[model samples]
Target: MATAEKDGKIYCRFSRPKSLASMKVEEEDDPSGPTEITIDLSSGKVIFIAVGKTYNGGNDLAEHVEAPVLSSGKVDFSQFKVARGTTMTLLTQLHGVAMVLAWMLFVSFATVEGRYFREGFGSKMVCGLKLWFQMHRVVTMIAGILTAAGFILIFVKVKGLSKNAQAHTYIGIIVMAATCGQIFLGLIRPDATAGWRPKFNWAHRLLGKATHILAAADLILAFRLPMVSPEMRHFGTTVVAVWISVQVVWEVTFEVNKYLQSKSPKVDSIPGKEETKIEEKVIWKDPNGRLQLILCILFVLTIVSCSVATLCAILIF
Candidate 1:
């Protein structure tokens, strides 16, 4: 890295390595010259000049040139060295892991305890209380804690919400708030004896469903951030695809089991009454099929959106 003064204006130049140069330019277009980054210290503006053409400082070079050189005509030579990554980057990865694990646990609880074991397997109680209820409570609490901690780490590293992080920050905040509301509603859930039981149940269910969708969206949006790596983003996409497949399979199985149970014959006997009653109780059901269809459509759209966004981010950086 070198700095120069011409016509009383200061400019900083960065020497491009062979590897980076080859990556940036085709063999035919290669100038066999170093790329120069010019910083206007007075105005705090920076630009890149290569192959006799100038380009504005985009996201890829912004981290290296913007702050240090723009602030004081001084480029930190240390930054040019091959990076081993940063602690903050590792923290962000950990945060993603925690959140993803939490989500997986949540999905397992909803599928196994809520639908499979409860409805298909005809399990009533596991530890005195309903199996689904116990698992849901435990898994959701862990998820909520992980979400909160991950959200806090963003602010801690960035010092404050940066412009690039605005969308992610807002969505994360909304998800956390919704999670709190979900926990509160779950705790205050009413029993069959209460007059407001139906209304309460509907509200709780709706809120929980919305929170899960929003949280998934938030996870996808994270891939757009600059600090995240492309390999990591691709891995995220794979994980999401697997999660979607699991959900689809679980939903189909649940629906099939429910239909079969409804069709099977049932008999209830009562003394002094020559009438038989048939009753079927299903723990999970989509009455109109509209909600399930809409949710599946949304999941597909989200996956496409995240994949496209990840590609765009990779191109930009």
Candidate 2:
């Protein structure tokens, strides 16, 4: 097949075989009406039939034309198979996977582990740096790098940004920008004693959460991108579901712990004052809280369900 343009209209010509005496070409300009072409090849001369339509030299060609049926003898057209080695498709898939995994690692491992350190549940110091802060910083840095790389890859693959880009593309840009802003805010985060500390902290938390949610949505949208296979779509959906489940479990656990800790009585005393009397705080001990137990069971069930469903989909589909 060859395509050419003349007189502001596009034309595509398919080479005919010698054994094919006559053939009919049909083009669907609309769902209800199709344009047809009849070629008489009985004169033993090579004839080229041009379909008067504007071809954008993309996958739209496949949508416009129907499969050709030879009137005479069978002709093998396997040689015209579309090549699948294009850089755009490969780079898009790479960008999608890399960005998805990077964000997943940030949410599932880095953020959760950092919280553990922050809450004094783990060792505070690691190799001279504060464990929580360092883990958060490193993971965020890696995630930012991956996001930037994927963002650039998309632009490179598309040659430049298009005004008519998909919603996912726009959302990705916003997510990357928000991530960069979040990183900057984190670097200049004030100490607990600072007046602006609470405000900054809330802003940082909210922005980070929003960015993660948007990133998850962007990953789901990637399944709808051109050239993505059904199996890959299912895989992407599974990853999104797993990430969401982990996030819900972590958030619920954190909230429950916070609520329990708030119920404990606090100590009131000055550390270095001579006239001050220190009053000890009452600690609440509940190793097996009902809410915690229920959340854990739910979390476990979610993980199991996601795993089984994903495996079944892979096998069945």
Candidate 3:
């Protein structure tokens, strides 16, 4: 065993011998023996020196040794400066890309698909399911898969949860858990004609909306993290702002169109002829159906544009 004393503070090392046979312990610290060298003074402030092979296969699990402190009572970390202009790790890039695609692209696409494309694709069927249902389900599933993968990659890169418990970390975990829950809820959704279908639909919509909001917030937070470049943060924040504006416009347009449809006559006729009222619920085939389809296409196009821009910013900046 070797011990270091600096500025009247003592630091010690404890270790098991490499040999299987036991040896007699010495009363005094050995200066010539191996020791555990302390590399970081920022956290846990302890310093050590290697003595021999550790008890647990080479792992060092020794208790903290009293650290040497300056007269000001501060442990100086001036020697451990972070490297400037260091490139981000590959895992971090992959994690960011995956999350951007999941929330900025797939989630938004899925929401628009379910909200406005149902009537446009109401007549089309994919297998036994409606086209809108298939598209929404598939897109949402992809988002969930991407979210899970991104979460795992970041967790592995970080080697576990953050010790400081950052807000970004907490929000990310919440978004991931909620995304999984949303997928499960979708799978167990009641049939359209079931008695509880209304409740299910409302629950699903609300959960989806909440998850989407949180996911967006998390992405913004990620852009603002200390590791991210300032250029990326500015570009990402701008892209998100424009994307949100587009969403608001699309939603307002849809609501206005729906309101106008409700107030207008059910059927169109010659200008001089009496308009007829239909009793059947509106799905498609209305006079404004083509307009709704056009609106959906425009909304989707705008969303895709914003997502692509944000992705490019993430990759380049």
Indicate which candidate wins on lDDT.
3
C-alpha local distance difference test of each model? 0.55, 0.60, 0.71
Cα lDDT tens digits, model 1, 107-221, are: 4345334444443223567788776567666767787787778777767767777755557678878888987897788778788799999898788767776777776677666
Q: What TM-score quantifies how close candidate 1 is to the native fold?
A: 0.56
Candidate 3 lDDT over residue span 279-305, tens digit each: 445443456577887777787788889
Clashes of each: 0, 0, 6
Candidate 3 residues lying further than 4 Å off, grouped into runs, are 1-86, 263-288
Lowest-lDDT window of 10 residues in candidate 1? Answer: 64-73
Question: Each prediction's TM-score against the native?
Answer: 0.56, 0.59, 0.65
**Which residue segments of model 2 deviate by more than 4 Å?**
1-88, 120-123, 126-128, 261-263, 266-317
lDDT of 2: 0.60
Ranking by lDDT: 3, 2, 1
lDDT of 2 by residue, 129-209 (tens): 677777777888887888889888888988887765788888988998997898799779888899999899789878887
